[model samples]
Target: MQIRDLPYADPGRPDVRSGPRFLYWLGRNQLGGQLRSLFWGVVHSGSVALFPLAVGMGVAAVVDRSGARLAAAGGLLLLLGALTALGDTMLHRTAVTNWITAAARVQQLLARKTAELGSALTRRVAAGEVVAVSTGDVEKIGWFVEALSRFVAAAFTTLVVCVALLVYQPALGAVVAAGVPLMALAVLPLLPPATKRADEQREKAGRATELASDTVAGLRVLRGIGGEELFLSRYRSASQEVRRAAVRSARMWALIAAVQVVLPGLLMIAVVWYGALLARDGRIGVGELVTVYGVVTFLLFPLRQFEEIAMAYSFSRPSAQRAAKVLALRRTAVPADDVEAVAGDLKGDLYDPATGLLARSGELTAVVVGDPDAAGRLADRLGGHAAEGAGDSPSVLLGGVALDEVPLDVARTAVLVQDKDPVLLSGTLTELLDVPSSGAVTADAALTAARCDDVLASLAQASPDGSGDPLRTRITERGRSLSGGQRQRLTLARSLVTDPEVLVLDEPTSAVDSHTEARVADGVRALRAGRTTVVFSSSPLLLDRADRVVFLREGTVAAVGAHEDLVRSNPVYRAVVTRQTDEEPDKELVESGKSEPIGESA
Candidate 1:
């Protein structure tokens, strides 16, 4: 099947849809697997379920006719048994292929979604939830999809056996045929509750996964505050909640299992009771009674399968809906399609109507504010992370194009934003700089700009299992293997490689030493000459090299001048940048009971 044909989130679809419709969609896509298994299912089920009944009929014929009939019936049973074995083998092979295809299609959708959303994806979805969906959820979904066809094939085989029984004795045939439906329908009432319970369990499980992920991600930080026990206690509570939810779900499923067994047995008993009465009245012969009983036994297989189909679907529906929600998140903004069709030097005039701030093109703009939250949100909008109220909210612009109007892919490739706390993905020194883009620049150039020329020398191409070198090496997840400064520098270096038209760096040199920070500032100015660059730092070294600095008073632009000009002309801006707020009296702080820090921390 083609990748595009697989179901993604179709948010527009109505909710009144049914399980049969879902089955049909899956079945339509399962042609290859079905075709491979169909003949086998037909042969194997027909032989295994139908042959015994057919033999019972033949045995009745032989008993009436003696030794002659017995010889012919024996030969026929052997032939049917061999056919059943062949069909059994083929059916298994085909069903597995079907399961695999369905799984592959879901994986493709997930991969495409991850690419479409980029950095914004993790912001919207938990890493552990995504991981669980890829491994466990996909398998569950594939199973439900594949089960549809086999379920139908089993039901159809049962129908054929019932018809054969009817031809032999109409009274028993009608009873057996009618009873199968009643047996299957008994479980229908239990399905909705089962699915509801399953959905609850799934949610609890996802929450538990998120809790563990959060704790592990902040493990070092948690230890620093001695809050590890607090978090561990919270996690323990969450795990207990999940376990309780799981038990409730298991109970419902158990009831379903109990119904599956009891209902079919009741149907078998009814057939036996009625068939005996007919034989006693001389309306049906003994051999016909045997065939009737055999046919009812054969019908049990499909009846059981019908119950399984109900159970499979009840669990899969909610997962599919959850997956759809993730796929349905609209992009933060819809940028104009006409982004110059090419890359060029972007004059760094940034305007955000939402915050009433503007940084003119071709200058280093330092946005100083008392509110860091406002700054970060504004940064996300500029970095192409989809904003929540972006539709009605005002936007930041670059090169006279509203940031929201720029397509995500183009905006991401063109404007790079390095957050203050950037993460370095694990890999060789080369790969770390190549994140969000391929390794397009020479390793030496990126390292020079990020000031990681020395850090690279300390690492080697190594593997856990040994023996591997290809100019590529895998790094540990989240750069846990590297030091904090090392990770930050590597991230800055990689962001530099793209050499975007606009570089909005939010404290890029925060983790490095003063000397390394100075070098990074010099390297940044040199590497970004003629390009629009904005570095969000209060460091004097970064400020000294700026072509211009726009001082922000609150959210609005209060004054615009060179770094020295702003320092001399604007009192509040100077006091804020130079950490002069501490000079204020302790009586003023105690009287107000609240105070604002001049240089805000993100």
Candidate 2:
């Protein structure tokens, strides 16, 4: 495929059984492109191999003082030169095409998998690892794909040249052929160590990259805790480890290069030394001896491809394996063929059989769980997330239909699960809120429901003259320019604008002030009065505003009541929400002060 037709119309499903299998699958997918590359590679290497023959013929013609034969040799040299340039040009074009196309195909596969897995992708794979695979790893994989054809053609040319030399002059050919194989095989034993060093280097580099990414992402938090120097020292140590590993790997590769050069030079010397004796004995002509020397010297160029192919495979194999591992991740439940039929029955309640969590339709239900990890798992199950080890877990029911059995598109449209740490993509405020608006929820309405007026005002003040429209204000990557509360509110606004039938929010106001949380809770209740919304929060302000609060203990529902009722009745619920001992109620604090019983201000 040409680079111009990039981003293939359809990057076909890949075979991701193993690294080598994935590489082979890539080759098979682009068979036509690979064949074209092979053809050009053959032409290029063949022309290079024939160069010594043409020079020898010309020398012989000159020695014989034959004008016609000399002219014929000169014409042959020009043809070979033209072929050499053409073949080299075409091979380069084809190889680059293969590189770009292969990278694009892998990129498409990654994108598809990410969409299929959604947030679970990040849970299964490290964000840094995903970033590495999508960027540098993909290029390395493409490098191997592009190099394969050239290596094949070069190896074939080397064999053909060896056979030709043996037929033309056995004594010199035997010596050169034996030395060439020795040169290629000599590096094999060293390859394992070289590969091991390379793996270590890559691992250390990845760790360093991950550390840097985390440090940058949490720079504000680090500064807040006065731990910047500690993290900096740790990163410095990681960077040094990466550096040492890279130096060791480089030394190994350099040794291999030294071997490649030294072996070929020795072979050339052997041919010349042996050919001189043959010439002295009058068994070979000067022109033929020159030809044998030239052939062996030219053969060195193609022989070097062995080293390149080996190195390429060594680096790319692990990258391919990493990519394959990511691609192999599939959602737990197999979606039914008739999604419409399955969804038709789903209309009453959302049920999670795994955790015994249920949300009544058109009600604002709040779930307060003591354990954050269990809370997260409950959220996943409620949203029909592919459970890691429970592929056979009963499907979450929405209405009467199984949520997992519904088509992915329909399920997403029906239920929107906003994680505790929601991400706000880089864009202007207007662009950020301009999602698939369901007409019932406008940008302004959603922003209001999310209590983002203060956030917008802050953005407006950050702009020129403190008069710029907040909608026009630009947000930095992942909204790093904004505070955590501001980013969370903006993400909430975006999700609200989608106006899905069911909205599941996990700790939506954990980062906001109690006053702001109170406003958000009230706004959400007023706006989603007739809609089904499930919020996972322990904050009393949010829970008090919910129509019903479900208290979860030990991964199961322990109590269900109004926030005030639960706080006064259940000691466990009171301890969780108020963080107080289960003694008599704090009547003075609960009745006299709104802020204390409601939640922490910050």
Candidate 3:
């Protein structure tokens, strides 16, 4: 594939069994690009190697005092120069194209894998590692892929030149051939340490990146708790560690580079000295000595390619391994044979047998879990996402069909779960609200329902001109420029616009005021009047608006009823919803089944 045909429609199924295999797989898929690069590289290296021969011939012609031979030598030099220029130019173009194409393909694969795994990707892989892989690791992998062809061409040209030297003037050629291989192998001993140092540097840098990401994500919270300095200190220490590791890595690579330079210089000196002795003895002509010296100098360029290949492989191997690990992740562990598509319409009750929680069709159900962690897990299960290390297949069902059996797209389409923390990507308000929706709800209506007029006004006021359209206003990354409440409202609005068959929201309004929360609750209930919606929350305002509330304790259904009825009957439910402790005397009496309804008594 050419550069213009980049971003393949299908990046193809990768062989993620191991890092080496993954790298091989990527190369195999781009055979055409590699061949193109290889062809250009051969032309370039061959042309360059022949330059010394042309120069040597010209010198010989001058020494002979033959005009015809001199003219012939000059013409050959001009032709070689043109060929060299053409070959070098094309080789560069092809190499860069290979790099870009490989990087783009890997990026596409990553994006597809990320989309396939959804939130599970983060659960299985650290966010920092993911960031590192997608950013730096990608470039390193591409570098190795692009360097491979050039290295092969250089090695081939070097071998041919050495053999030609052996045949041309065996006396001087023997010394030159013997020394060239020695120069190439001189840096081998340093490669191990260099690779180790590089890996350590990458590890430290990844940690630093993750730390920085976490700190930035929770900057507001850290400031509120007066812990910004603590995090800042920790981050500073991490950054310093990364810096030190980088210095160590750089030092090792510097040593390798030094070896490459010094050894080539030594070989050149040896060749020139030996050639001078041969010339003095009349064993070889002055022009041949010049050729041998010039060839040795040119050989320096190809010799460095050996060190470059070593460095490229050292860096890219681990990067490919990391990428392979991420790509190997599966959203759920259901066997392929068991994956039966949903046979009917994608409308049904969303039920999780693990928790005995069922969200009925065409109804608003609110789940109240005492443990927030359990609530989050349940939400994931309701959306057919098995928890990490969960051995059993996801047992959530839709219309009696196991969710794990249905295709991922089908499952996602049937149930949409919005966790407590929804992220708003950086974009204009209009782009942020634009999503694949059922077309039942308009953006304006969703925004109005989420009570985002104030958010729009603030965005507009924050604009530099202070008079542009609100929808056109650009949001900062993660909506950091907006208040927590505003971000939450905007996210909720985005979710509402989707209008999925089954919408699961976890604490959708925890960041908002009571007044705004109540309005959001009412708006949600009205908008989802005939659609199945499951909300996991404990707020009285939200629970009161629910048609039915399912109370979960220790991951099992403890009570199920209307919010008012549960509040009056179940002491534990009342304690959870009211944010009170069951140890209270009145609550204890109700728990003991010896008192009136807590609501009536209060």
For every model in order, what is the number of clashing pairs?
A: 7, 6, 0
TM-score of 2: 0.84
lDDT, residue 278, candidate 2 = 96
Candidate 1 local lDDT, 530-584, one digit each (tens): 6677777777778877876655655666666667776765566676677667444
Question: TM-score of each candidate?
Answer: 0.81, 0.84, 0.84
Task: Give the distance in Å from residue 342's predicted Cα in candidate 2 to where it truly belongs.
Answer: 3.3
| lDDT of each candidate versus the true structure | 0.70, 0.84, 0.86
Off by over 4 Å in 3: 332-348, 371-377, 386-395, 420-499, 508-531, 545-547, 554-556, 581-602
lDDT of 3 by residue, 1-602 (tens): 77788769899999999988988998898788888888888888887888888788889989999788888878988888888899889889888888898899999999998887677677778899999999999999999999988998899899999999999989878988898888888888888989999999999999999999999989999999999999999999999999999999999999888888898888888888888888988999988988888888889889889989999999999999999988887644455555444434556877787777888899999999988987887888888765345555447888887765566776787788899988999999999989999999999999888899899888888665667678888999999999999999999999999999999999999999999999999998988889999999999999999988888877778778889998877777888888887587365775586643323210
- Say which candidate scores most in lDDT: 3
Candidate 1 has a TM-score of: 0.81
Higher-ranked by lDDT: 1 or 3: 3
Query: Model 3 scores what on Cα lDDT?
Result: 0.86
- Candidate 2 clashes between residue pairs 3 or more apart in a chain or in different chains: 346-399, 346-400, 346-401, 347-399, 347-400, 348-399
